[model samples]
Target: MCGIAAVLNLSLAPVPHLRPALGAMNRLLQHRGPDGEGTWVHPRGVAGFAHRRLSIIDLATGQQPMTDGRGNWITYNGEIYNYVELRAELGAQEFVTTSDTEVILRAYARWGADCLTHLRGMFAFALWDEDRQTLFCARDRFGIKPLYYTVVDRMLYVASEVKALLPFVPEVETDLEGFKDYLTFQFCLSGKTLFRGVGELPPGHVLLARNGGVETRRYWEVYYHPDFDHTAKYFEERIRALIQESVAVHQRSDVPVGAYVSGGLDSSIVAGLAAERQGPGFKGFTGKFSLDPAYDESAYARDLARSRGFELHEVDITADDFVGSIEKVIYHLDYPVAGPGSFPQFMVSQLASRHRKVLLGGQGGDEVFGGYARYLIAYFEQCIKAAIDGTMHSGNFIVTYESIIPNLGSLREYKPLLQEFWREGLFEDLDQRYFRLINRAGVLREEIKWEALGPYSPYATFQ
Candidate 1:
């Protein structure tokens, strides 16, 4: 992954200062892409694009802002799994490099903006067309990568991370509504961000900006389409195939690739699959808390690594490490993220970065599968509500509020709301309420003070 930044001058002023602004933004995102950096400055009255390279693909020649023979420039921050195929289709176009960056330029030349539909990987990118004088930006379908942008005084500012925009636009007003959403949803949901005027590009969406006008459009959505005709075994088979395919595509890197094994079902499954594909003696990494036994899972991780015959590197984190890393983590994250999980993830990434440039993580498995313990609780609550309302026509209750609700401190205050939610059948919709159950922060608008919230409150549809 890499960080991409761009500035489109609506005033049509000379954009000589944009290079330093782009540099400052890129510095904030250095952690995301540490290998190298490149900049594309357009002719006067146009735009500029900057990219920080992580050197994942075509490390020797895949620099940006890569351009076509015709002067159309591109700055991308994602992997295109189909680039190899697209390159063959664009044969004899006087290719300048083997990097996916050049392939992206060629693909755009051949297919225009429609090339995004053929890609299958996590990415956020910006392409500049000097001929049309328009800029195109897009984020991948799953939002595994991120893109944030802001518009001020008719000047369009975009970046792979929000911190990049702060220097150029000193009026970085805190987005209170976004914070409320952040507290409610853990992470800022969908389009809302932590800064006023800055917004995240939703997954599977595209933004086109030209002549001081900007428009956003959706390209994909992940709906819940259950295949009832397929049995549980069929699901397992399909899941295995999908995982293998995803791993194979994600493994396309010029640098060495490794897996983060957390000893949990998801990470272990990913590790196992990767090990099976790479043969014996593949590498895996894990992290554990030294002071907190309850939080430590190193033993399980070690056992799995040994059983699978993989090289395992384990790091033990102490309370001091947590304290020291908190500020840096928050800085790198660009905003306050929910839960303690990010700490371990950051440490794991640091460790993995030492031995391998790219790491395969099982980040999305929990969301895709019915894995979380809270899911079971939510399902049980649904069943209890249905039985209590006589919808199932059963006098027997599966569970009660008293039995289900914990006696933990501060939780008692939410019991009434939880009970009301149960009574009102609020848990009937699994997908919608899943965030409420998992998010440590209360829902935006409801729990957070309105003054602390920002104007982006109404845009959070996922929450």
Candidate 2:
């Protein structure tokens, strides 16, 4: 939602050139924060922090490079959904601004490093502690916002985007390991990027820079332990309640917000619920393809929009548009982290931006629910292997196999799956074989063979 950048090195005062480079880096992220820009350089010339604001909550008062008034300063990106309550809990100290940014600074004053626990939201922030002469940075629990950094000669350069950090670096070169991961998994799995010497501040982590040294440690982890004790009906009611509560809170914006409905079950549910809160002035956005019926879900979206009384906006994207703007979209992405659909999402974002500054959509439903077809294939293979091993009956295997084989026929359309799974490791143990086959970005493509790639490939040594 915003862009934040910082330059830190306590070992030496920041030279005159450092400020220009920091400004350049911050300027590169203007699109992320078209509302306004703020820059704060430590008078001692040791550090500089910059922010690009989108003007979400407190349009007038919520400006970044906000200070705690004791020389400690913060430049942040994100919304603390619980900031209202957090401000109340922090004990009234005659609040100055209504922005969440102030809440974070004050919360840090009270809780120190433990402040991370009291906060709940997506954020990547850098706070300068003038008293301790240390710089503290943190990323949200999930990777909703991005923070990338690299240290060169004790000077730490951090930014919301990897491309923003490029301005401060001497030269840029491909990170081969990141490329190999992309070739295998269609994404970079490691915190490392496609650029050498650049590293990501992993989610749910905090960074402390002081005395010419920086230390980063995890602050939170989302562990999964199924609640088997709870009744199914209880969980169903709880889920419905949570969804309504979350939608209610998110609708608390001062600006008009829109919905992006994909017509999928997940997005429809969100749009439907949000429509309950939003009025007739609410608008919905959807992407359509006139050339492909299979990819066109705009009709279903139209139904939802009509039923929900939403003024719908639909954009029909073509292959030519894909070819033209893909390079631009990937430029904004900083790397090819997403598939071809990213360009459509880019168009969708652009459309949503024209109507409303903020739009809520069911983006991570598949990841959260394991709704990906790959999960189905992986589970099916496990069952078939269990049947062959006599761990499960052959009758169960037949039913599962028959039900799934029809879908597997389309596997030929995907070269990675066929090339990786076809007789590649069939003789190996079931899990082992499937492991080699499953992530098919199952990420197990045979082209990822690193034996002869020598010891230079980071992924090779890593695997």
If scored against the real structure, what TM-score would every candidate get? 0.86, 0.89
Candidate 2 residue lDDT tens string, 1-463: 9999998875857645777877898789998999999899888788898889998888888988898788999999988888889989886565799888999999999889999998887899999988888899999998788999998777899999998888667789877777666655566655778888888888898989888788888999978756657776998999899888887777667688888888898888888888878777888899999798988999999999888888889889988988888888978988776556788888888888888988788878888766665655565666667658777653423235556667666555555554656546554555555456534244445755656433554334335
Tens digit of per-residue lDDT, candidate 1, span 1-463: 7888988876667665777877787777777778888887886746888888889888788888788868788888878887777778789456878887787777777788888777766788888877878898889998878888888777788998888888766597877767766666666665878888898999999999977688888988767754557666998898789888887877777777789988888889888878777875579999988688888988888988888888999888877878988888888887876667888888887888778877787787867765555655575566667758767545443344544455234344456546534443364466556555655544335555556444554334563
Residue 65's lDDT in candidate 2: 84
Q: lDDT (0-100) at residue 7 of candidate 1? A: 89
Model 1, 225: alpha-carbon shift in Å?
A: 3.6
Candidate 2 structure lDDT:
0.80
Clashing pairs in 2: 14-45, 438-442, 439-442, 439-443
Task: Provide the lDDT at 463 for model 2.
Answer: 56
Question: How far out, in Å, is residue 27 in model 2?
Answer: 1.5
Q: On a 0 to 1 TM-score scale, where does candidate 2 land against the true structure?
A: 0.89
Tell me the lDDT of model 2 at 294.
Answer: 88
Candidate lDDT (C-alpha), each: 0.77, 0.80
